[model samples]
Target: MSAGPSADDVPAPDPRLVADLRADLAAVGGDGYRVDAVTALLGLVADAALHREQPLAARRVVTAAVGAGDPLAALVGAFVLGLEVPSDVLATALPRCGLDGAGRLGLLEAVPGGRARARLELRPYAAVDAAGGADWWVASDLGETATGGPLRTDHVLGVGGASTTLARAVVREPVDRALDLGTGCGVQALHLRRHARSVVATDVSARALRVAALTLALDGGAGGDRPGEDGAAPGRGTVDLRRGSLLAPVAGEAFDLVVSNPPFVITPRTDGVPAYEYRDGGMVGDALVQHLVEDVGGVLAPGGTAQMLGNWEHRDGEPWTDRVGAWLDASGLDGWVVQRDLLDPAAYAETWVRDGGQREGAAFDALVGAWLDDLAGRRVDAVGLGLVVLRRPVDPSRPRLRRLEEVPGTGSGALGAHVADVLAAEEQLAGLDDAALARRHLVVAPDVTEERHARPGAADPEVVLLRQGGGFGRAVRVGTAVAGVVGACDGDLPLGVLVGAVAQLLGRPAEEVAAEVLPAARGLVADGLLRLA
Candidate 1:
């Protein structure tokens, strides 16, 4: 595999050029470029090829992006098209920054005949979170699609699928302080500012931190301690960029929320197989993820929450839950873990090796073999990928809520509100006794629906399911008594009274029916299907 640019090659984007670039991006129209526009520009065949990590088809569109008068087209050619453009074309694209400023920003390198090629990938990014929609520019090392080769060890990542996943998963309620651990390119930090009063983004790689600082600067939320125009001190747009691994930089300091899309990829420790710092944590097996699970709560204030994306190894005899459960137990924090994907050894090996841009060649085969050997040595059968949301209990005397399950298709979209609601429910349920819970009136959530299925010739339904229309889309199988109880919950009567009425209709003891249905009711509330009125 051929190597791409090193971390040292990434130069600090000047704030002045950042301002000019921001203006240039705005002049081209909203958010610079959209996915649909690029797709239309590249056509179906070339777009599909580009999605498959091959840039040859995209390279064919070089003339289109460069020759067009739109600054969007010229900017696309210079960066996304991966083509050297004439100095005049670049100047036309970024009239304020110009080629000289681009070169100063280390985004482009001067070539022969006054032509310049992009040394890095810089583009506009747009997103809609709980706060609403906004756009910003981001710069990171060129990927395999841009370079058509392997990535450097410390490649600063751009906004990709994983970045967006964590961004949407983050709980977006206003808070006093927030921290973005292992904040590569500072994408999470940028999003955190939407809700957090102050955000501190930290990373182990100094180069990554520099790139992250540039990313925030380009986005208008420039990091540092500078005061605002009115002299009231910087607010939402200000971030404190720090350099450290895990939570060491902010040790003993407490935060209301924390988010991370860490280097949780499980890689083998074998010779000739390069461990990329962006993904690998330089630890054996899944130790890095385990360590985070065991320690992230130390910096969290009471009732604070942390969300992260990670991977765990599964041995032959033990279940995936057992592996992750142990880590949660060690942390002593209330946690809800959702395993999103699982991959066998072969599939896992191919995914990572190819992720490093190594095709199905001898090197790829060798790396796969090493990965398999490493797994075999540990008696591993498969790997589980998931999202974990943890919280430090406000009442230390209460037992921590521990929930571990697999949700392969939790569906897509922002889950910040759903997660926050679940945590809140857990706290509420933990505080309430059985008598107190039964006395409270409840209502079914707006997004919940009931479905009944029966045999073709049958008159009465045999199966009943309560499905959530949004927020994790959980479907709960309900028995006759529970189904009736849930159907009657409309914020009018207390749960105990409803249970008594149902028990009378079924000719059963109220105490016996209450014992059976109350647990399920609590579960429904915890998952956001039902709420206290």
Candidate 2:
């Protein structure tokens, strides 16, 4: 309820308190105070559901759990579940660091009648990336679920859907140096450490950098230190936190990889509209995402990859690809964009207005009007929300890959590995001509299956669908010729031989079959449906 800490007055977390808190949490249960333990202790199914977003659902159980002298549950109840506890109970729970120490750490504040409430929200974070599954504690400002109101303008976000989406979308590859731009709470920076030898996390808000520093310290598997005067060393994998807007902090520095879940929300530049620093980049329309795409290349080393999430405006008659592709053309980076979802002006406005915790009332209506007017003035029809992957080619003279398409609901597993495969395929395909490609042996990926659909009485199938069981879960409809080529791919013979054999069976010229199937085969290879033997 106290308006949270300002940028300048942001309190540094005490290392002793953090250690005590970690030990206190570990005493309760394994996984370091997991959500399931709290839910099971509370015995409330409704409280366990994160989609509900009502933190008060487990109040009774939280109070009871705290009263029962469960230190982990007490901390979870007070900080995560957002409940007030008596000063004595809190002191008993965190005996190492009493209420005074907690107050100094900016975690909780004392209330009347010997009671105290948590100011900072803390919870266990679990992730499964290329390095396998891991757990850590993350601390950030209380959200609307706890505060029961709109988020503060400079709110530091926890592990939300957007951050999770970006975490999965990023291509995880081992590199010497990586950068996490707009590193809110340092989620991406943590992921970056799994592969990159060193990470540089930068943000515009000092408050956000403070929260990120706290997050990095709490999740201290790697060395938790800011970059040195000469940057990070080779094997230490330092997590360096910097304060600046966008790429200004990293100017004149080139990174091997850069990942961001940036502040890409488009907002009206009109007066009276609150610009949340975590979401809005203080730009007109979709320029923030554009600026990142265009300018991020400056900091990317040759052969470096930059993966980010963004929103783009689509005007009437103009395709979303053209609108977003223009930014890539200007960036001069090889780009792959996948527009996952699209929203009309009305729907987009409603979504953002509600995101700010504004209910459907007069003030909400006024804000919605401003959004609509801004869109109309710019001749915008809809907005596309998607993931972008850009790579600075080692050889700039070649024609760069510019693929813009719609790929939605790609499933829940880590897509980073898949993305890396696709990029490698792109690079391999770039070097191979048609004749060279035909000479290489190809094999259908293990997860791929072929399905034949036909009428009940028909012996011959009317349609064939090659579906992928892993990766992007894409289904490619193919003709019999291509299907025969795929079925014959046992890593036995080169693709040219298989095409020739199929051509002989189908009573067609070998050259004709080779020309037709070769293009489709290349497409399949790029998407990981087929692999080189």
Candidate 3:
């Protein structure tokens, strides 16, 4: 990967300092500095305000806590809140790693009046993966909130919305080998370690890899090939850091699982445009996303899975699915894409132009105009942003599952488990012939519910709906035939028997009713609305 002029001021990853910092943070981070504790201290209004980029309330709360000799308040103010703390107070906050270690790590900058300020963002991160809950301190380059200016063209992002979205969306099943492509600050790699026996984290920026190494080491996972188990994983492992762009670092090797939140943003290649490395892969338009969609299969072992978040253009005279479907047609893998949002050119331009801290002004308007011109040149109508799930089937003869649709509510539950179940069900359904499927017993998922809609005084329902209470929260309208077939699926009767009873009750041929309901049954099974008995 090309370095291409990024931030080089970050301190090199020092194993000793990282370990010392981890110990010191743990000493103070337990009850006082944890996510819950910090939330409690900040109160709901201030915490909510901080998320909205209004930090005045949080600053007030932390300022008072600091006066009360709260070490956590000192840590939060100096690092998270971007406030300068007295040197003595910071020293009290971190006794072991202390001020010297902080200086060596480039985490602190000396100010006048014996005060120190944070050069990096360090905060407690807590989340639940498929395995269980985790709490770890993450370090990354400070952002516009702290710097009070535009972001660097090659900023290494901390734990942000995009990172967490991909993290929660990733399939957390255990794997023998895994790869985290574009591992900025090693957030995804941190989760990968919990399930993968070996993890290869690669990045284009040497600075990013350096920070990633520090993050990995601080989590007590040693760098290199020696396998180690964390409390969160059944068989945790080592992280091997590599420097390269895209799939170059692991060219010949294939992994059982690969997760990437790549720099798939569509950006103009015009001279004046700042190509941020964290978002832009130095590629024009949406070609980076296209390249990843088509080429990621090369690194997947048989039956291996890959999950990615990407953006694709919806050109005029073309559907969004056709644009992404073409990529999957070229790839020899089963693909499922869920488009979460569709933004028009104007909205897209405004969102991205302001992403680099450009407020409404002449320069911001100019950049937005540039985005509009670049997009219009390609006849782009809108851009669809979504999650992409791909799997290289173990059996090459198996038919590919190429599904692209919009699911409203994702990231609301354990999506990893739901995806795993869906994949397994699809594979099982594939092996079952029509006759075999009829013989199989199925059960309605516990979260499944039925709703009926009709005219105010009508006896029969005009519309029947089957709704999923969890795992994507999908709702599908069904005919009475299909609805009856599903409602009787209590794992007590075979599917064919249920269809037969519904047909007999309606005075219709069993074959016709089965033909209508079977397809819907298969779909509901794959969507987690029904389960195999």
Report the number of the highest-TM-score candidate.
3
Q: Write the per-residue lDDT of candidate 1 for residues 1-533, one digit (tens) a residue.
A: 45545556666556677678667766653445555566667789987987776778777675666666445556666677667777677777677877788777778787899777887777667788898886776777777777777777787778887888888888898888999999887788878876887888888888787777667766654344453221212236457888788888999999999899999888888879888877888889999999998899999999899999999999999988888999999999998898888999999999999888786888889999999999999989999988999999888788789999887774557888888888888888987888999998999999999999999999878999999987888889998899999999999999999999999998999999999889989999998999988
> What is candidate 2's lDDT per residue for 49-152, written digit by digit as tens?
54477555566667776777666666776787667777776776676667787777677888888778887787777788877776766777777777667778
List TM-score per model, in order: 0.92, 0.93, 0.94
TM-score of 3: 0.94
lDDT for residue 401 in candidate 3, whole number 0-100: 87
Query: What does the lDDT come to for candidate 3?
Result: 0.83
Q: After superposition, how far is residue 274 of candidate 3 from its true place, in Å?
A: 0.9
The residue pairs in collision within model 1 are: none
lDDT-better candidate, 2 vs 3: 3
lDDT of 2: 0.81
In model 2, residue pairs whose N, Cα or C atoms come closer than 3 Å (at least 3 residues apart or on different chains), thus clashing, are none
Note the Cα lDDT for every prediction shown: 0.81, 0.81, 0.83
lDDT of 1 at 391: 92
Candidates by TM-score, descending order: 3, 2, 1
Q: RMSD, each candidate, Å?
A: 3.0, 2.7, 3.3
